[model samples]
Target: MSQDKTILVVGTYDTKDDELNYMSNCIRGQGGQVLSMDVSVLGDPTAPTDYSKHVVAEEGGSSIEAAIDSGDENTAMQIMAHGASMLALRLYREGKIDGVVVLGGTMGTDLALDVCQALPLGVPKYVVSTVSFSQLLPPERLAADIQMILWAGGLYGLNSVCKSSLSQAAGAVLGAARAVEKPKGDRPLIGMTSFGKTILRYMITLKPALEERGFEVAVFHATGMGGRAFESLAAEGSFACAMDFATQEVGNHIFGGLSAGADRLTNAGATATPQIVAPACYDLVDLVGWKPVPEQMGDKPAHDHNRLLKAVVLSASERRDVALAHAEKLSGAKGPTTFIMPKGGCNEWDRPGADLHDAAGLAAFVSAIEDAMPDNVDYVPLDCHINDAQFCETVLSIFDGWLENGVVKA
Candidate 1:
């Protein structure tokens, strides 16, 4: 018989015992084993739990009895969330669970986020919550690969709609656990960051060249969540090397625009990952046309990339500051690092006479990076745009050298 996949079903069993039981039965029906973890702080769970509320609360540094005595729902839930996350992570590490599925309304979803974030990528985490993908929970706060489904008609009781949603969630997680191939340890994994495909065409050449050379390249979108995932994966030593070409998130993060949280652009250096850093899209910051523009971008070149997505051009002064910020982060790298400057342009939009083109701004950014770059970092200035064929060749050649010199391994 094939090994049965175990899915950890986490929720407030005291409140949603029937719902949890239904989901557990669904998972069992799908030929998967279920490990129920109850995070309820009040009342007893109708179903038997492998990890009871008392066990969960204790992991969170409090006991369920203490939480009940305190009489603060928020505090008790907070404690339960932490404890549940700890227990869930422990179970995953011990190979007791192959996937996790959690269901709830607001409180359950909040706790689910903790559990999801506690697990690493490729663990098949799913959350069936009423507040599915709500803006209140920013992308940076959750795990990069969490799959959330709207819990339609799932509030207050068991019903046909709730059962359908729960059943689908169970099947989805089980299928994922069965089909998802775990990462192979054969080829070295290379993490690369880029914006839109059209905007960052170098990846087309960059990716194939690296793959041909026997390295697996993973490209991450330069959005807030994508950046956070890249950073998180880097911190976990998931990459043999990284080519961080898209840095618009840094501008947004430093300027309080739509940022990738406070941790953008700091991971590879901290983790000693050999990285090639570029200011590919650092000249722009993300903003929505519906929101009021920042005073710092007053009268500057702004491109309405789309109705809701606007790119504000940074001035020469702002670009200089961003370069300095890049320096501050890159200078502390414990591994071999290179900072490349593409002098012709940073992005497709930054080409001469393009919407984001500004000669003075580019000059200021390059100059600041050059002046501030530490001796440990190799600073290379190429007289070509970032997406140029020559620039791609230059980067690949450097990677080849790194590979041969043992700076990066295949």
Candidate 2:
């Protein structure tokens, strides 16, 4: 392993020997030292196994080949994934590697993502898979399981695409190595979640407000990847606080909505960075269009923006469950936190008279907060709705509290 370098070629030599070897050569040829570590599931390895998936497999309960010998690729894949994550995380802890580059076929991408997710944020990571382009592989499982782990943008397994993606990924890793020498300042990063509705509000108002108060905020657009990316950074210790102002996606997660589950919903908040987490827009579910709106929701309350992408008012039962769950999740925050309720409504169309507004649901939402909230946190109700300027200001004020007192010892 090259301690002096950054890019590390990580893959299973059992299958991707040729591709990984090529990746290693390209990385070194471009002025980046490459360390080839085997995440091989085939027992002993020829390449340096910095943190073997075999070890993780052994430790995490199952071996891949053992599972395969029983004629179960599905089981083997599951075991391999769990083991890969453990192996990558071990390497990350020891600091023997910096960046990771992987090459594989269908099984390769699946196994590769397992390793990617385990490594921390900002590390250069790449995966070149032959099965990447095919619809044969389940995109949702692949996405939910592996996307966050790739330190670099991913490449499809197609030959042409791999060639393009690998070259860029290799060069990017080298650049990351060259750039790491410049130490960053001490200002803590803050994670912010918003949507198109609030993006403008944040840009014109909140963004400057946060920066002026000394917080370096990273905003996520409440979309699946965007939300997941923020949580990923948070788990990697990237943010000191968060303003989860747009949580409408919870309904999207529960429904089969096209958005995303955006894993680790409560992760950053629970880490305790003086989180000002709220039920922001927990009152409604995002629908691609009004056509899919369930029969119970009635012809789109008044703010049905367009026939295609309409916001459906959540049911009284759905609102109660989600609000209860949201409050329960927000309570997981490890740092000082607050949950604010705006008396009027949550989003643009959620005010007192909007068609999408479900005052019954709103009351149930706050009631759940009051009844189910964890004792470790504080729950405060405001005299405004989500779109109200006061609610925005209060959210910022809580972050300010963290900016003053949220340095956890390293």
Candidate 3:
């Protein structure tokens, strides 16, 4: 059930007619507006379509179907994603859509998430899938907002037990849509990520710099979704600017870790707007538990940054690959964009007594970035270390310039 409050039901009408209708009826029976959008990947249905989306209700609102005839697979996929997003957005604007419910095995879940993910974060997006029971990412990777994954083996067509399951799912999403209270604020949102080493830089300098400039910052820890989040918010228009301060996700993303959350590290940076970036945590990847540093890592070197945080020192080649990926993403950075580097240390842990500190690794990271990056960006090197007072000041000054005067502060 939707943890928040109003319920919206979504599904593919062509294949799952009996099931989608059953869930819609259940939601309506409980006093929720069943905003059912028919996604016809097969052929057009008779349901009352939303706009030019080729959807219509057959026996009035009781049965829904697709309106289009046979089409190419890729074309159909694009249509489903577009139509799903449109339906959700329309409902969202009218204040009717609260929580969204989606059903199907693979294509069904994919189409549903297309719409569900379009909903806001606090809003619940629930999907009952068959293929997803094995690994959640295969399907969930498509979801943008908060999602609930339930593996019902395979709920392809309608049946007695399947109907019962869909009914309950519908009940949940409806309850949530009606109750969630959207937070109200006028703060200009900016998304950021920080780690223990550089949390001070965010709290001490960057946050204030933006807040003083009238931007409200939303900071996420540089765990895994760190860089991804900062950039995603920028894409959703949630943030005025994204300060990917602690780009720790890059290590997890490139090195194979469960934390990167399935997508590219900086998918959002591929879009417009200038984003400030640095090798915040280009040090290495952390393993689950140091049980002899695994096998392939082989006598290379390691750093156990406590009992939990185990980082494998990245090799020069790996560092170059990461730098290339990062550069490719930021090559799309428009307006006033700058890649800042600190000659000293990128993180506090890189200084004196920190366990994971590796000067050679940090240097390799810098060299990789410098070499792999295109000539389009303005790369600056600060003489002081990352946490040094002057370096922090320089970052803030540059940020102010981007926000106001236009390029290179002080």
TM-score of each: 0.91, 0.74, 0.75
Tell me how candidate 2 scores on lDDT: 0.63
Can you write out model 2's per-residue Cα lDDT over 255-329, one digit (the tens) per residue? 544344445357676555656666666766666574656765555453455665666667677877877677667
**Residues 268-360 of candidate 3: C-alpha lDDT, one tens digit per residue:** 454445566666666666665535576767565666667766767667777777777777767766544577788777776667567657677
lDDT preference between candidates 2 and 3, better one? 2
Q: What is the lDDT of residue 229 in candidate 1?
A: 84
User: Which regions of candidate 2 deviate over 4 angstroms?
Assistant: 1-5, 42-96, 130-169, 175-185, 197-204, 258-264, 287-311, 352-355, 358-361, 396-410
- Lowest summed lDDT across 10 adjacent residues in model 3 is found at 56-65
Q: Rate the local accuracy (lDDT) of all candidates.
A: 0.87, 0.63, 0.62
Ranking by lDDT: 1, 2, 3
For all predictions, the C-alpha RMSD in Å is: 2.5, 5.4, 5.6
- Global lDDT of model 3: 0.62
Q: What lDDT does candidate 3 reach at residue 133?
A: 41
Count clashing pairs, candidate 1. Answer: 0
Instruction: Candidate 3: list runs displaced more than 4 Å.
Output: 1-6, 13-22, 40-79, 94-96, 120-124, 131-140, 153-168, 181-185, 196-201, 258-271, 286-295, 298-310, 371-373, 384-391, 406-410
Clashing pairs in 2: 116-149, 117-149, 129-157, 270-333, 270-334, 272-334, 272-335, 289-308, 302-355
